[model samples]
Target: MTTTTPDMAPVRLYGAEHAADPERSYELLRAQGPVALAEAAPGFVVHLVTDYRAALDLLHDTETWSKDTRPWQSRVPESSSISQPTQWRPNVIFADGENHAHLRRVITDCFGLLDPHEVRTLTFRHADTLLSAFADAGTVDLVAQYATQLPLMVFNSLFGMPDEYGPRLVEMLAAMVGSDPARAGEGAQAFGAYLAGLYETKAAQRGDDLTSWFIDHPNGLDREEATQQILLTLGAGNEPTANLIANTCVRMLSDDRYFGTLTTGSLPVQHAIDDALWNDSPVANYSFHTARRDVTFHGTRIPAGAPVMISYAAANTCPHQGVPADGFRSGNKAHLAFAAGPHACPARDLALLIATAAIERLATYLPDITLAVPVEELTYKEGTIHRTLTALPARFTPLAPDADGATPWSRSSADRGSAGSPRTAPQTGAMASAP
Candidate 1:
């Protein structure tokens, strides 16, 4: 049992204070030692692992830690924000041992079948479509306009949906995870129906997409199993990838190493992405594990069934890791941005491809783009798991459509509103943890 004094009370991980400066929260956690208690929701306190070695050991020790959240879920309110991520599902994320391996193989194998070149080409196409919507405008919010939509559009195509359904899918997902409970419930239902219809279509006639591959795979998953797998992949990949893009872009634009010379710089986009992974990871805290029995983790005695989460942001910056004086983390990939162990991210390569291509494509079109406001003025969203910016306002010289009229955005301004605008409105509250 844990007792708290006035100075040792659990630190709240959500709201404006944590959003503005999550590092301060980490500082508080560190003072309590490697494993400390933090309030994930209003009243849900969980043990947070803030040290690198402890996080790694805990992640790899499956015998002591279980991914299953049923024990923890029974304690939290159905309406609590933590319920969404902690909710049990029939996917690899919540499975253990053999079940985890069985489900994960389906995802890894399907992802492996994707040709790197095709994935890059697909990413570039969507990036162009999104950029075209705002190329003529002198100012745009990269978070809303480009980063958030690109991954959703690409994943929709990969999952065998027609291009026309991309916008609606994005809208449904945003609402499903948005702050408003009523809208969130409605969005969840709509997204579920959408997934069912997608599986149905794929079942009737297979296409060369992930959905078709998932259905036709030798694993022979039933409709419900296949649907849950697809849902897991989509929900896991979307927001983290979006935030990776936005965070990398913001870092490059703000740092002198690449700000003015984004196109030609010693620090490339990959470096910025890695820096964000180390210092400001998109998935701040996740990999929820419950102690199988009484265990002393880093001198802290966590009782059986206690919820423990890994703080990727804190562990990556652990002073023991010794960040270089210059603050560059590109060549080094040891960071926990993707977590570790068997449950580590399976689609990291695809995410890297999409994020790199999105940033490179933006630079090709808007070489002179600059931030509309000071970097410090940018606001972050309030959440327990993700480090996301509310908006990324930027300015650039307007580029009109070419003389031959092949580019139609210049011809009609009204289309810009539909095309360039955010595919889904910004939502707050619980977000699905990326695997």
Candidate 2:
């Protein structure tokens, strides 16, 4: 089953069915050619590059392929969802050349200031706080109760946002990514206004947060640029992390290969994360590159100003890719989940840290966790770029929150393991076990 626009060519990825099982669609697209053209939306045809080597070449050929969408302004309708203006933003994601480097350096440096140990600590704390809300309920939607809220809480702390503003910001972000296209612009506007307020507040009184750091950075970003950078971080950071956590949990609960070893205290949490990255990356497809001029590569001609989107999902899973031959092997971080080239994700390390901590803590606290519904019933949110689960309903033995706001089987407890008991060396696994 495939969907097509008025032109009768298959609409590459804009329906519920495709979202549910995008890999199958990717297979079909790959069958056509390495570079298949399809309409992402009505009258908005895009080149979906699926071949691994081809994608890398395009990504690295920054001179021929640009990130700027200004050339597309005249080609697409102003109101079209795929129009350049609709997605235009002056952030690292859309910038090229020196502009891209300048914006990205500040973000990279800001993330570098975060201590990995501290990030893990904060992640565990936020995970515990969110889990406490649903730990008493034997059955709960993990996506809503834990996965979705954990990153937002952690980001709120990182940005030093006021407690009152966190929930509202999360709500606006959710609405922006939600099913309703009508609300996206409104959400973007609200998000900008809220960040502008944060910028003003941080300007007047600095805090030990990324926002403050950006404001005071030697790069000298003004309030508007600072706000856009904050928006970029939040927009790129939150949903992908949420999806990673949820996706990892789903694997832990459903896959006997991992579940059996995890229960037996053999499988490392990082292995599950790496596996998810290879097989089911949260942000399935991204890195929209536009042709700087008329170019023909691999026998396909991409006209000047044509929009090209790389299929990270398809590239990672392509059988001919040859990197992960055995599937989800630990220490194999070659997957393009973080993308490649100059515009790859800057905060990938932080993302991995938070995801590992969240998953490890969740597994430790709820060792008996299982799916509330059949695996077949799990559905994905519909979209071209993201592979987000609609919800993750899970069942686990109810755990009581400790008086000190810690789980009985928290990391410390796992480390100390009952004061007088002889400490056995922790079991070695495919990946380094979480500390």
Candidate 3:
């Protein structure tokens, strides 16, 4: 979707139906035109940037499309507030230019500075508990047992919260996942309250966790402000990480060929993780931005104050955009799973490390953990903002290492190699193999 009054190249974007399937969705829009105006919500129309170069140009040049919360408020306005939009100013995420730079710097060192030792320690700790529960059980849902536990633990420990709070955070995050941003205010309120509680406890004392960092650092937020940030992170961070790992598992189990590639690859499973982000975006759409100025994309004109959406899912999958033509190529991991340019996720490094370690270890631990469920049966909770997958049930025969692949349990033919009852999990294919 080009924003040139007539200066540069035209912008490329997709249509509405592609909201759920952005990659495919953008293709149709790009085919329709380089720039397509899309109705993302009621009385809202955004110019989709389907073309790669154009998307790159616009995302980086914040001068043109700013993330300033004052200029353009999000339809899902997740502010660091006790109440809704009118109640408070924007959070760190909404800041632009120097403001964004300064706030981002507080945690700038945190991502890269995240010690591998920490990741190793937490992964093993959570894995021990999770796998023990599934031990000897012929058919266990890996997503529930393995995939979900690791990242939440990583986030909780990193944030310095107790294990008791982890379940509550995960539960609250599930509530916000697919709810409309406007209607999700209640979730936001509950999250704010939770963060306030956390802030009060951490304010009294200090520790090495992120909460303590925020409390002590001059550049960081005060306990109350930090609490809001924590709430936002918990709500946003939990599911994306969970979905990335679970979705990867589904991708890997779907095809033996892909699984075999992972197994034998000299490189680590990082690329495979990228493939999951591009192929199946966990956060499907980031929508409903009010246009700050008069801008015309393609022939369709959008006056100032129009709602625009930057569809990262659609952008990554477009042939003309990111990733090489060969989707399976190991080097095509530069997909836009973590948004792009100015708004690129600060947690990119940490998130990737966590996902890679989780998936790599998973493929190593349970090569026989195939999907026990079908694709269509998998239900996704959808709202104007995201695509949140609820349950991924799979029946797999956790046979001995020598049991070969897809063992059929005894007693129940479907349960396989006998031990547990038949279960269901939506099969999205497995993401990690041996690579």
What tens digits encode model 3's per-residue C-alpha lDDT throughout 1-435? Answer: 333232333222222343344445555556645456554444333566555555666667666565543433344234322113212234445667777776676666554556777876676556645554565575766656666666776687777778777666655554553346753556556666767776777788877788777666667575545665665465456667777877766666664445543335433466556667877766655622445677655444656755455666666666653435666645565566677786677776777677777776555444456666676565554344454455666554453322323322222345343332222321333334443
**Tens digit per residue, CA lDDT, model 2, 1-435:** 222223335546767778878888888777657787665655667788887888888888899998977666455555443443237688888999998999988999888888889888888877766777787777889888888888887888888886567677778887876557779778878987888788888899999889999888888887778888888788778888999998888777776556643325556677778888978988887788789889876657678888888888898888754455557567688788888889889989989888888888776666667788988999997666777888988876665545443333333444434543322332322112344
- Model 2 TM-score, all chains together: 0.88
Q: Per-candidate TM vs. native?
A: 0.90, 0.88, 0.76
The backbone clash count of each candidate, in order, is: 0, 0, 35
Lowest lDDT 10-mer window, candidate 1? 426-435
lDDT of each: 0.82, 0.75, 0.57
Q: Which regions of candidate 3 are displaced past 4 Å?
A: 1-24, 69-89, 142-149, 176-190, 261-268, 287-290, 297-300, 321-326, 374-379, 398-435
lDDT of 2 at 93: 88
Clashing residue pairs for model 2 = none
Better of 2 and 3 by lDDT: 2
| Positional deviation of residue 64's Cα in model 3 after best superposition, in angstroms | 1.7
Candidate 3: 10-residue stretch with minimal lDDT: 80-89
Q: Per the 3 Å backbone cut-off, how many clashing residue pairs does candidate 3 have?
A: 35
Candidate 2 ranges beyond 4 A from true positions: 1-8, 73-86, 179-190, 261-265, 321-326, 404-435
Model 3 Cα shift for residue 242 (angstroms): 1.8
Candidate 1 lDDT (Cα, 0 to 1): 0.82
- Greater TM-score among 2 and 3 belongs to 2
The whole-model C-alpha lDDT of candidate 2 against the native structure comes to 0.75
lDDT (10s digit) by residue, model 1, range 1-435 = 333233568998988899998989998888888888898888888999999998999989999999999888887666665677778899999999998998899999999999888888888788878887888888999998999989999999899898888888888988987879899889999998899899999899999999998888898888888999999888889999999999988876777656654323336777777888888898999999989999888878888998888999999987864667766666789899999999999989999989988887776556667789999999999888888899999987676664344433333353233443322211221111111
